[model samples]
Target: MIFEGYHPLDKTMFQVMDEEGNIIKPEYMPDISKEQMMEMYQLMIQTREADLKALMYQRQGRMLTYAPNIGQEAAQVGSAFPLKKEDWMVPAFRELGAWLTRGAKLEMIYLYWYGNEFGSYMPEDLKILPVSVPIASHLNHAAGIAWASKLQGKDEVTITYFGDGATSQGDFHEAMNWAGVYQVPVVFLCQNNQFAISVPRGIQTSSETIAQKALAYGMPGILVDGNDIFAMYAAVKEAFDRARRGEGPTLIEAFTYRIGAHTTSDDPKRYRSDEEVEKWKKKDPIDRMKKYLMSQGILTEEENEKIIEKAGKIAEEAFKYVEASGDTVLEDIFKYHYKEMTPQLTEQLAEYKAYLMERGEA
Candidate 1:
């Protein structure tokens, strides 16, 4: 007999830590060691530094366009920590913290922003997919990969990242349907960072909470305080555990905000007011995490300085490495496609080489 208890559809937001970094639900906290907490803090610091450096690179015309992940560090880093090495991460473009936590090198990410295709080429052992720029396109791909893992009887789960805006895409629903029917091992992380390039979350959907939509797809959905790392980590770990137990998929709506412009080209002030930005800024993920660490005596002021310094050094080294590598060969792009080059590609390559040679630029 099913008891009609409290439904999560009642818009209950799960939060472990408050904006002031106080633990509000100690009983609900995950079993994260002090070492794990320190690591999470470091990842958040590194992410913020990387974002700032990328912005500078863009301003100086040293890099291509970038999508900043300034305020959502806790949401990305916390959720990424629980995955085993064999687990797959099919990521959207704005997942710098998550990628870094999953062992991706800063140099590779920098190369990606410099328009180097080699940047997105992750090592085979990492099990992370290349950044998907088209919104929600990889939704079904994550399901397909997880489904294959299930068929093979491998104990692996696939976790994918997307924005709240992606819920509008038909691919999202299709992926949900597949996961629901097959009971595949996959976790859907929707970072609801307020705006999807100027469109507010309220305008994105009529549902009171994005998590509630999971009911229609026959899955469990949890709305988490994205700025609270503790809550974020706990929710994601539980979801993955459920999937590994053959309980099917989960949808996590991380309630956070994007502190910066959507991309380098965007001007957020054109739509949202400065006051709203200031409000979210006060709840900055990194700051809250720092407060929690300090309160627990796990992080000292000296140690905090070192973490920030190390992160800055890493970003600096990445920028230097990418700049020193020089531009990729214009013709090299044609090589990775096919061993036996197509007739049209061969013709184009030959034409381009001839043109370059004529101009003494080959």
Candidate 2:
């Protein structure tokens, strides 16, 4: 496809569905069964509910710091579904749904937020890297992995998720340039939620759109309705397929809204108006999918209630597991640094342990 113009604003943004619960683009519809589509919608709803509950737990001091993925469930879950088992996924802080869809356990996610180092540890078989808090730094890691996979002749692609704010970072640009030059198998998924903390997307950059940045890298850049599950699934599947076919990288900008605080520590009311929040609520991804499902007679009120109840139960179980897991040990900080603790780390651990012992807190 020949893309005209240099900005996503001037190009055609692909979308399969509309906000009014209509599949406007029949040709772009996925080949998945109706049952599977309903299942995906159910899972996305469950994830959003779970994420909201986790935020409540953080506010009540029952859980650690939380990042709410309230409005981005479809973008996260749908994009994650097309990933292969062997492919690598590197996530930013706001990707709970993506991580869950990629096989991360709820308990581990809760534990990680509760300050447990082990929570960052993913099973080697899962091929998911640790959750990165340093914003765009993980883009470099993803690029490196893809470069190595290409060199090894492995049919693997790396997908990394970052926010619109992270797009302005030096590391993000560097990784894009390197990936483009090498033609590495990587997908740069940017969820442009219109804000980087209190800074709105308008103030973040004067660029026409985040997706347009990919033009400089010589890769296909797609803009899609992030709230529309069908659009997300189609865009990501196409990008993944191209990568597998050795066509190199693609950049996808999922246009959506945050609809919540940046984190439990943040208060959006300080910067954004309640009116804006209410406006986005009407365009909620879960509600859109629910409407579509109900129109198909695949989802009913009772089914929706049951799914919410089950998600609550699962979240409660995760909280219980995290609480029963106990606090992290002081020595654990030093243990995971290396296969074996170095002599300097050993001395520090011993000194810290001695101080705790003297205070009867070890």
Give the clashing residue pairs of candidate 2, or none. none
Task: Give Cα-based local distance difference scores for all models.
Answer: 0.91, 0.87
Among all candidates shown, the one with the greatest lDDT: 1
**lDDT digits (tens) for residues 1-362 of candidate 2:** 32232247675677777888888988788888888887787678768878877888888898777888999999998899888898999888889878888888888888998889899888888899888998799999999999999999999999999999999899999999999999999999999999999999998988878888898998888788899988898888888988999999999999999988898889899999999989988888888988888898988999889988888899888889988984887879999889999999999999998999999988
What clash pairs does model 1 have? none
The CA-based lDDT of model 2 is what?
0.87
Q: What tens-digit string does per-residue lDDT give for candidate 1 at 1-362?
A: 00012144867788889999899988777898999899999999999999999999999999999999999999999999999999999999999999999999999999988988788889999999998999999999999999999999999999999999999999999999999999999999999998999999989999999888888888888888999999889888988999999989998899999999999999999989999999999999988988989999999999999999999999999999999994787866876467778999989999999998999988
- Worst ten in a row by lDDT for model 2: 1-10
| Regions of candidate 2 where Cα sits further than 4 Å from its true position | 1-11
- For candidate 2, the TM-score is 0.96
